[model samples]
Structure formats: structure tokens, C-alpha cells
Target: MTIHRMLARLAALAALALFAQPAFAAECLLGAPGTTQRVEVSDTGRAMTVHVPGGVDRIRNLPLVFLLHGSGGTGAAMLESSGLAATSDHHGFLLVAPDAGIPVERGFVWNIPGVPTITGEIPTEDDADDVAFLAGTIDWLAERGCIDPDRVYATGLSGGGRMTSWLGCVAADRFAAIAPVVGLRAGNPLPDDPQRPDPATCTPSRAMPVYAFAGADDTVNPVAGGGAGYWQYPMDAALARWAEIDGCREEPETVAVSDTIEERRYARCDGQARVVGRVVAGRGHEWVADNEAMWMFFWRYRH
Candidate 1:
């Protein structure tokens, strides 16, 4: 062969070798099961801790869950407190806990629409685009063959829960289901239409299944919507709006989860959409059986 032709062939082979490398090679490598690894999520240098269960790669169409932290929270805190990583180990799904971009009180915070963050006491434009960052994270994992596109789920605490609700509003088509704990806030009613409620930021392209939990005695976000502090929707109003969006039956089935917790399941919905409201009686603003209940709720639906 001519020297020029040989050089061209060698260059082509080198290019092919480079293309064979995984785009997320630094992030997607399998680590010890249940061990957390922090990796970059996007071009902006955002990062999250991903936990893979044992034998995750062996399973087909594995489910993935995004666990978000509340205001003044971090990914490490969520991993330590929520016990979601343990759940992932038991269920053989991938778990990712992302750190919010906005910093507050020595921790991070999410940019929930219309909600006053810990960093900003007053409502204002969001400092970071968390929605886009999470969407990019999901796509990145999908590209790396780590997550099932049809079975993605999201759940979170207060500010993070509000962020989860925002996902249900704008990113309905991307997730199978969502469960927000102690954080259900609907938008104010539209002008000249008290009967119709408008959410803070919703552009739902599909019917999203939701299972929300709230503390009846939550002084921070009282279910009655009349407590002091910033104005927000009550739990019932938020559930009603979700039921309307999902086309669920008017009445809900009431079941007592515990002596203190009541579960209201909204049934007979379109596109397999349903909403379950778990009101923890006498409890304050905190999580209630969040890990188990949300897993059960999320497993029932798929994108």
C-alpha cells in the first residue's frame, strides 16, 4: 500500500477508537454497590451523587429515582437522612441525589417557582435553572445506558418537593410519577375566575400521576392555607387541581395508613393518572413514610 493511503487508514482507525469511548466514562463506571459517587452532570459543572444497586447492570430497563433535598439541604444530607439509597439497594434501581445550585445557610437550595427560597426571603426570578439541569442529567444517564426512560421518578422535601411539583407541571412527560412530601402548594386562583385555580408554573403536556404527603399540623405550610407567613395553597386545593388535571373521579377513597396518617386515594383517572394525598395528623412539616410510600406509588406508573 502507498504511504499516504496507509496514513489515512491509520487516522480513520484512531478516530473510530475515540468514538467508541463512552461520553460519560468518568461518571457511569460501576462502583461498589450502595456506595455513592459524585460526578459532573452537565457542561456547567453541576454534580450529583449516584448510587447503583448490586446487579443493576444485569437488569433490563432498570428504574431510576431522583431524590431532591429541601431548602438549606444538600445531596449528602438527603442520602444520609432519606434512606433512599438503601431502598435502591433493595429494589435494584439507580438513585441520584443532586445538589441545588443556590447556596443558603451553609447548604444548597432549589429554585422553586413562586416560592421564597431560603437564600431569597422574597419571591424573585430564580437564580439557577434546576429544571433544565435535571432534565439534562436524565438524558445524560439515558445516553450512558444507566436509566430506563420509561420509569424515571422524582421525590423531594419542602423546597425540593416544590421543585418536584414544578417538574410535574412542566416535565410531566419525562417522569413516570412523583411524590412530594410535606410540600404541596398550588397557585392562586385566576383573576375573574375564582372557580378555576392557576398553578405557579405549569405547562403539563401529559397527565402526571402524583402521591403527595403533608402534615396536618404543619405550621410552615399549613393545610388550611390561612396560617401566617407567605400565602400558599392548602393541601386539599393542590390535590383538587392535580385531580382536575388528571381527570380523576370527584370523590376519594379514605384509608387510615396509621392512627395519625390518613390516605386519600383519588381513583378512576385518565391515562392511568391518579393522586394520593397522605395527611399525617398532628405531625409538623416533615416526611412521613416517604421512602416506602413513594416507591410503591412510583412503581405503578411508567412514562
Candidate 2:
């Protein structure tokens, strides 16, 4: 071949290879190993995306982690941004990211105010049965096999983070541990006012391990924000309340890891569940890169 023609052909081949690389990687990323399966599991028309590591058999009980997305986010976005799927691939666990079922202007939202009652009240468009949907999802995963029922855990950001708190309070029986990022309890007031429900009545079925992370400077959910609107309770106060709920006797030991990350842990609680709070120094409303550390914290507790 002529030198000029050979050079042109080589450049075209390189471009083709470059384009093929991402397509190949995406296929692998969205397939069997290190990928997710989309599932629709209810007459209620609820849908979820489940990511299972390759070669995981239905016989062995594998650890399951639920990664929930924030407001204006989707299951795929959470899996991509939180890096939990990569963690799942490395840690050999099954990761599931379920859609919140709320249609926002951009993406989807978790129905924070949509929890149901036994009165058979139908859920409105804004209302979602996220608690039941999650419970049902876990049950579905358990039936599929290879999932350890005792090791089911959950974590989320923003609105999803709020849903994680709701799961901890209302669906504690199903989850062994939970980590809510930049989210707090709705703490709805008591009485069956269709407008507001009490947070006090939403007691947990068991003491599950909880590791909370919030930026001291988070304007979206500030620790000092009044009432249940934002972070509501001060950071220390929220940790204290959780400690009290879990019956944790050990005082918090604060350890500054760096200029941007601080770790505070409360151990020796009832059911051996511990509460660890990470106060990100000078950070705002975002996920900490140390989520692997958070997962490690959540993995310690078993049902």
C-alpha cells in the first residue's frame, strides 16, 4: 500500500477501536458481571434494577446492598455516581438500585410522604409506597436466592437518603443496617391528619446499625435546620438520638482523618449495632468518596 493510504487506514482503524472500546465496556458494565438487570415486580407496577455480580449462584447467601438515588435522580445515576456497583464487584456482593417511582422535572424522586397505613387508603400520584416496595423488593431478592436475608442493607442520598431513614424507622425488620447521606427523619407529627404524620410513632422493629454522613455546611439539609424540613436536628443531637434509640452506651470518639473528613463512632449498642457519623469538613451537599468506608461500617451488622 502507498505510505499516505497506509497512514490514513491506520488512523481510521484507531478511531474505530476507540469507539468500540466504550461500547464494549458499557456492554460489560450493563451485563452479567458488574451490571444490572431491570425487574418489574408488582401489580402496583413498581420497577427496580438489580445488579448481581457474575458467577453468584442462587444457593449461596450473598450480601445485598440497596443503593437509592436522590431527588432528580434515577437508579442508573445512583449506581454510576455512588460507585457502589464497582464496590459490589470488588466486595463480591449483590447491589440493587430501585427507582423511586416519582416523576420529577428531570428524573425521578422518592415518595418521602407516601408511606401507607392499614386503613386501605389508595396512594395518590405524589404518594408512593416506597417502604412496601422496598420490603417487596427484598422479599423478591430473597426468593431469587444467593442473597443473605440477614445481611440486607440500604444507603442513599438526598430524597433517597430521606427514604433510607424511613426504611430504618418503618422497615427495620427487613434491613440489617442503613446509611442515610444528607437526609433526616421526616419526624411527622402524630394523629391521622392526611397532611402530616408523627415521626415518634414510626418506631423501628429492631435496632439496626446506622452510619450517617452529612456536611456541616450542607445548606440543602443543614444540621441546624429547624424542624424536619432539613437536617432538622443538629448533627450531634441526631447522633445522640440514634445512640439513645440503639441503646448505645459508648461515647462518641471523634477522629479527624484529614482536613475534609472526620469520623465519629459510637459502639457497644444493643444488638451489637453501632452508629458512626462522618462530619465532612468544609463540604457541602454531595456524596463522600469514603463511601466504601461507610459500606464497611454497614456490613458489620447482621440481622
Candidate 3:
């Protein structure tokens, strides 16, 4: 680990130890572990389904992960498809699958501040603040002693993945890390180029730990780019941009992990952090992320 990263982790651990106690004494708002509870966020008029592991207490200083569904998909659907609850059960963390606020035909799409969605709809400031809603959810859970506020993380599919990327850009301090699947962008594409991210649109408060995933056979949100107005840059460009944002000094390295999965990473980073990703050879535009693999990346960071 870089000395800077080691010191940051140590400092964060000290802060967590000092501040996490009072919240731990409070009763958690959700049902006990081994069960799932659907929660309504009355303020945002959206909902989330939360789950914890079987054996851990509500106050175990656990890691928290948010799973975001694709466009026209619900949080419960994401939970079922990602197979993440099972991984949480085995690893002992809190999991919440949250819905997008804007209602589309069958489901919802995120209200990313200034960009248009795949539906070709641009979000107005009047729309529900999805970013605030997500960050607020973490504060609410921490208040109820339901999760470790410092260990919070997020991951999502398709449109949800774009939302995940947005969070890493604007709410880097609020979330320790983020993983966006099938849909990853540093920011809205530059208007002139349409194939490059506009740097001004995604300046984060910190170097966010980003692990992204895309499938080789996907057509909807192709890894090589060119799909919707919202998706114009290649997946590698997105990863490379994040690697630059994270101050990684080395070129990305790729290794064939297996027939289906190819692992790529930028390991020499400023804070002992890595920008990592996977490309699934045969999979398409679907939830093909390894839940275990994502959780492993998430646990390495803390707010």
C-alpha cells in the first residue's frame, strides 16, 4: 500500500471508531438479518429493499452496498438477477436495492443532473434529486445504527450503472467506492465529440475507487461504445478516464482469467487504489457482474 493510502485508511479507521458508537446503540429501522424488508422513502417517494446477513447484528460496523436496476427495471428485480443477497449472506454485509425516481413506461430511470437518459429525456432541477436521495439514505441508515456509514458502496446495472458512475463523480466523499455494470461513463459526452467525456462534468471530491464491468457481446450498451445519446464513449475510455482521475501512474494490464472473464487493472495508483474491470466474453447486456468479486473490491475502501 502507498504510504498515503495506509495513512488515510488508518485515519478513517480512527474516525470510524470514535464516531460510530452512538449510532450503534440505536435500534435498526429494518427487519433483522435473514429477512428482506421493502422500505419507502417518503421524502423522495421512492423505495428500497434491504437485506442483511443471517448471523451479524444490526450494529456490526458492516459494509453497505446499493444495487441499482437498469432502465425499466425495479430494485427487487435487480436483487433477484444480481444474486447479491446470497453473497451478502456469506460475507456478512448490508444490501439495499434502490429504485430510480423518474417513472418510465415499465420502471424508472435516474435523474442525472444535466444529461439526457437513454429515453432522450433531459432531467430538470425540478426532478427528484436522485443523488441527494442516495446520500441521504446512507445517513438515515447510519442514524438507525443499521450500517457502517464509512463502509458504504454502490453498484448498478445499465441506467443504474450510469447513476452509480454519477455518484462516484459528485458524491465521492459520501460513498467509499462504486461499481457500474454494462453502463459506465466518466460523465456526459462532450457535445462536439460525442465520443469523449467532458472533464468539467465529472470532477469528484476525491479519487474514487471504480470497478466497472461490460460484456463483449452486448449491443444495447456496447463496450466499444455507440448506442444511445447518453452512451457514446467506449468502456475502455471510461476506465482509462477513471484511472487518470485516480492518479494511477501505470498503464492498464490485462490477463485472461478464464474463457469467459478477462481481468484488467491499473494497479500503480496514488493511494494504493486500483481501477479494475472485467469483460465477459460471451455475455450480453445483462447483469453479468460477479457479486463476490464486487464485494471484495468494495470492502477495501471506507469513507
Candidate 4:
């Protein structure tokens, strides 16, 4: 072969090797189960801990659940407290707990302020655009082959619960089902008058299933009450309104889950959606142990 031709061939082979090396390296990196990694989810440089379980290469068409922590809590704490990871692992699903992005000395709150009964507003200043961040997180995970776009779900406790309601009202299309524990409606009393940035205005474009839970005796997000510092009215009103929107039948099927938990299911609604209200007996403002029941109920429905 001529020296010039040999040189040209060698150059081409080197270029091919260089190009193939990176692809082969990437494949090697993706060969294992997705590892737990921290990702910056917001522009403020706040990071969220994500557990991919197995690396991206091992995941395909996987369902993901966003677990929100309550007031004065962290994503890690909420995940640990909720015992959701175990459930996710058992069910072959991905679990993600995003930090509230609010820095609290001990933990964090959902950015909701003011007493429930009072005619006061829950300050939303620290209420960063969590909805956008969540959407981005979903997209990011999807790119990693770690999330199933059609099976995304959200659930939270207390303030997190309230946030879930907000998501249902605002980003309804993003979630197949939502489970809010100890949270109230997005905007109570339908917000007297419609406004531009109102959550009630963003009702689901399509029917979305919701499973709500609260301790009947929950003094924090009470079940029935209307007074200064009471927020239960809005919660009750929201559930009823959602029922109407979903066209749920008036009477709910009441059943007992356990001595401490009684369930009221409103099913066969518009779009075949349903809401199961789990009234915890004597429970306080907390994520009751019956979460497994709620999780089971949540897994049954999808978009």
C-alpha cells in the first residue's frame, strides 16, 4: 500500500476508535443498576437525593412515586419515615423524595403558614415553583430510562399532603393518581372570585384519581370544623368539589381497615376515578401506618 493511503486509513481507524471508545465507556457505566445520586433540581442550586435502585440500563418502563415530606422534615427523613422505599423495592418501582427547598433549623415545612380556622392566608412566598421542579425531575428521570412517563404518582404528609393537592389542581395531567395525607384543598370556597394564579382554576384536564387520608381527630388538618384557625372546611369542601368534578356517587362505601382506620371510598366517578378517604381513629396529624393500604390503593389506579 502507498504510504499516503496507509496514513489516511490509519487516521480513519483512529477516528473510529475515538468515537467508539466513548460509546463503549458509556455502555459500561450503564451496565450496572442505577446508583443513588444527588441532582440539582432547582436554579437556586438546591439538590435532591434520587435513588435509582439500579442504574439507568436496568430500568425500563418503571413507575415512579414522588414522596413529599411534611412540615419540619427533609426528603431523606420522609422517605425513611414513610417506609416507601421498602414498598417500592418490593413492588419493583422507583421512589423519589424531593426536598421542600426550604431551609429549616431542624427540618422543613411545606411553606404553608397561618392557622387553619382563622381567615388568614397560608403564606406562599417560600413556595418555590415546586411544580416545575417536579416536572423537570420527571423529565430527567425519564431521560435516564428510570421513569415510566405514564405511571407517575405523588403523595405527601401534612404540608406535603397540601402540596399534593396543589399539584392535583395545578399539574393534574402530570400525575396518574395522587394521595394526600393530612392536607386540604388547593383553594377553599373556590377562592370567592376567580383569579389568574389560582390553583382551583387548574383542575384536571382529565379525571385524576385521588386517595385522601386524615385522622378524623386530626386537630392540625381537622376533618370537620369551621372556626378561626380551622382549615378543615377547605379540605372538606375540596374533597366534595373533586367528587363533583369526578362525578362520584353521593354515598361512599364505608369499610373498616383496622381498629384505627376506617375507609370511605367514592368510586365510579367521571373517567372512572375514585377517592378513598381513610379516617384514622384517634390518630393525630401524622402519616398513619395504614400508608401501605393507601399505597396499595394508589397502585391499583393509573392515568
Residue 71, model 2: lDDT of 78
> Which of the numbered candidates is closest to the native, going by highest lDDT?
3
Candidate 4 lDDT at 217 equals: 72
Candidates sorted by lDDT, descending order? Answer: 3, 1, 2, 4
TM-score of each candidate structure, all chains considered together: 0.83, 0.77, 0.89, 0.76
- Deviation (Å) of 151 in candidate 3: 0.4
User: What are the clash counts of all predictions, listed in order?
Assistant: 0, 7, 0, 16
Q: How many backbone clashes does candidate 3 have?
A: 0
- lDDT: worst 10-residue window of model 1: 187-196
lDDT tens per residue, model 4, 1-303: 999999999999999988887331111111234445555643456666565554333666678889898867888888878877667656667778888755566775554333221214454655555677788877776665656778898899877887787777767778888888887454443344321123445467777788888877777767764422324354455666677667787677788888877877777797778877777888878886465665676677666
What TM-score does candidate 3 reach?
A: 0.89
- List the pairs of residues colliding in candidate 2: 62-146, 188-197, 188-198, 188-199, 189-197, 189-198, 190-198
RMSD of each: 5.5, 14.4, 9.8, 6.3
**Candidate 1 lDDT (Cα, 0 to 1):** 0.77
Query: lDDT per prediction?
Result: 0.77, 0.71, 0.86, 0.68
Q: Write the per-residue lDDT of candidate 1 for residues 1-303, one digit (tens) a residue.
A: 999999999999999999999674234554676578887866768889888786554534569888889888898788778888778888888888999878787889877655567654644464777888898988888776667888999888877777788788888878889888877644444544433357544657888898988888888767766453333557777888888778887698899977988988888888988888888887887766467667878888996
Off by over 4 Å in 1: 1-27, 55-61, 121-126, 187-200, 227-231
Q: On a 0 to 100 scale, what is the lDDT of residue 201 in model 4? A: 50
The TM-score-based order of candidates, best leading, equals 3, 1, 2, 4
**Candidate 3 wrongly placed segments (more than 4 Å):** 1-25
Candidate 4, residue 153: lDDT? 89
